[model samples]
Target: QTYKFRLYPNKKQEEQLLWTLEKCRLVYNDMLAGLNKEEKPNRLKLQSMLPELKKQYPELKGVYSKVLQYEVYKLFSNLKGLGELKKKGRKVGRLRFKGKGWFKTFTYNQSGFKLIDTNKRLKSLHLSKIGDNISIRVHRKIDGNIKQITIKKHCSGKWYANMVTERNNKKHDKKISSVIGIDKGIKYFLTDTEGRRIENSQFLKNSLKKLRREQRRLSRKKKKSSNYNKQRIKVARVHEQITNHRIDFLHKLSRSYIDNYDMIAVENLNIKNLVRNHHLARSISDVSWSAFDNMLSYKAENANKTVVRVDPKGTSQEYKYGRDLDRDYNASLNILERGLASLPQGLRKVTPVEIEPLQKLETISASLIIETGSLFQNHK
Candidate 1:
């Protein structure tokens, strides 16, 4: 698990952090330049060049050793990512050197970092090169051994520290009981098999007026001027606000479902392909279906629950009854049926109820709709 905390670095410490980031970027570019010249690039050879690099450029010696080495690892990781894309027949580009202000993060891997918990609410993160006593606000207690700490500077001029940790998770033997299938949409955030609906909180859409005003103000400023930089941060703040609101809503909604259900079934949507449709792209992005699915998966694993992804094909189009069923509700039922079918025979405890008469299913659906409407009204 990774825990992110707000960092409050002093002016001198902030300058040190920025200097380290720039130094790491330079090292990354230097290694890339060397790799391009060589017929066969070796990781070890590139790493060994660091000591010599410090001799040539003595400023690097001021930065932490492992922190500089991580830049090499990051370079190869990018190369591997590009290779995977090329294997899938996608157009790939070579890694380019980072320009000024482009690099915003630096990592202290395995060593050169310490977390000191004061008796007070605030903690301090100590780095090797950067000064100690950098106040950190850890909202929640961090469990497990910390593997690394990555310091990042946001476009909004905020600093954050992400602590990656390692821990052995105990396996949970939970009996499959409550089950649900959810169909995601633009109108409602989701509709479940039981006809419950959660309204979509269009954070980006709601803030577009303010965002447009900020952008217009930014556009009026001269490029690379002090005013331009200040206005740029104002625009970034609006985007940051939208992101935080969306994430908070998703966290609460996903947590509610996880707390109530044992198994959750959802459509395995190819979000990248769906976003290609220009008309629906904005709505789809606003809904953030992929982010919600990811939260459910991770949270379920921690709780020893189950999350199943069923093929979305014909889910909305196929209906059993002669009368028209709600598209999202029908899709959710199909999803639930498919989810149960995919489970092992012994584990498949609850099967979809088979209602022969159309009138009975319609009545149940109507009643559920009314119940959900009341709940939404109360929530509002």
Candidate 2:
């Protein structure tokens, strides 16, 4: 598990943090440069050269040594992954050197980082070479052994610390009971087997007016000027707000489902290919179906529940009782049926009630219709 916190570094400490970021970026670029020249790049060989680099470039010595080492390891890890992809006949791109503003995060592996005042509400982080007691907002309790610390700087001029931790897996013994299948759409974020719906937040679209105003203001500013930089940060913060809100909503919704249900079935959407439809790309991206499914998978696993990804083909096209069912409702029923069939007979508890035909269903509330869209998608 990884817990992220808002970091509050003093002016001097913030300066040191920025300096460390720059040093790490330089080291990343230099390592990539060396790897490009060599026919065969070795991780350990590149790591061994760190001491020599610190001696040559005295600036690097000021930064934590382990942070620099992780940069080299990160490069090699990427390269190794690419090689594996190539072996599987996938087109792989070469590792590129980091340009200015490209690298935003640096990790301290194994050591050089500590959490202070755990008992207190407001805690602080201590890094070996940087400083002592860097104030951080611990919004939630972190329940694990922290394995690594990653400091990241956002374009919004905010600093964050991601604490990677390993926790003892508590296998949940809760008996499998309730099950659900969800169909995701642009209108409602999700429609479940039981006809319950959650409206899409549409965070990006809601913030678009402010975002465009900020971008327009930014574009008018002279490039590289103080005003331009300030405006750029403003623009970044608008996007950041949309992202944070969207993520928060997805987390909460996914967690609620994971907690309540023993099994969750969702469509296996290939979002990468789906987004290529230029007309639907914006709505699809805003909905973030893939992200929701991802959250459900991990959360369900942690709770010893199950998440099944059924093939999305023909789900929307399915019908019942000699008439076309509501698009998402039909898809959800298909999903739920497929999920239950795949599971062992004993585990397929609480079968879903047959949904009434679209014509006979009760009137949907005006507020709900305006909040989302009409329940039924136009069936051509």
Best by TM-score: 1
* Candidate 2 accuracy as TM-score: 0.89
Q: Model 2 over residues 257-346: C-alpha lDDT tens digits?
A: 777789988888899899999999999999888888888888887778999888889888777534456777778888887776777666
Reference-based lDDT, residue 124, model 1? 86
Which number leads on lDDT?
Answer: 1
- lDDT for each residue of candidate 1 in 75-123, tens digit (9 for 90 to 100): 8888889889999999988889899999999999999999998877789
**Which pairs clash (backbone N, Cα, C closer than 3 Å) in model 1?**
none
lDDT score for residue 315 of model 2 = 84
Off by over 4 Å in 1: 354-380
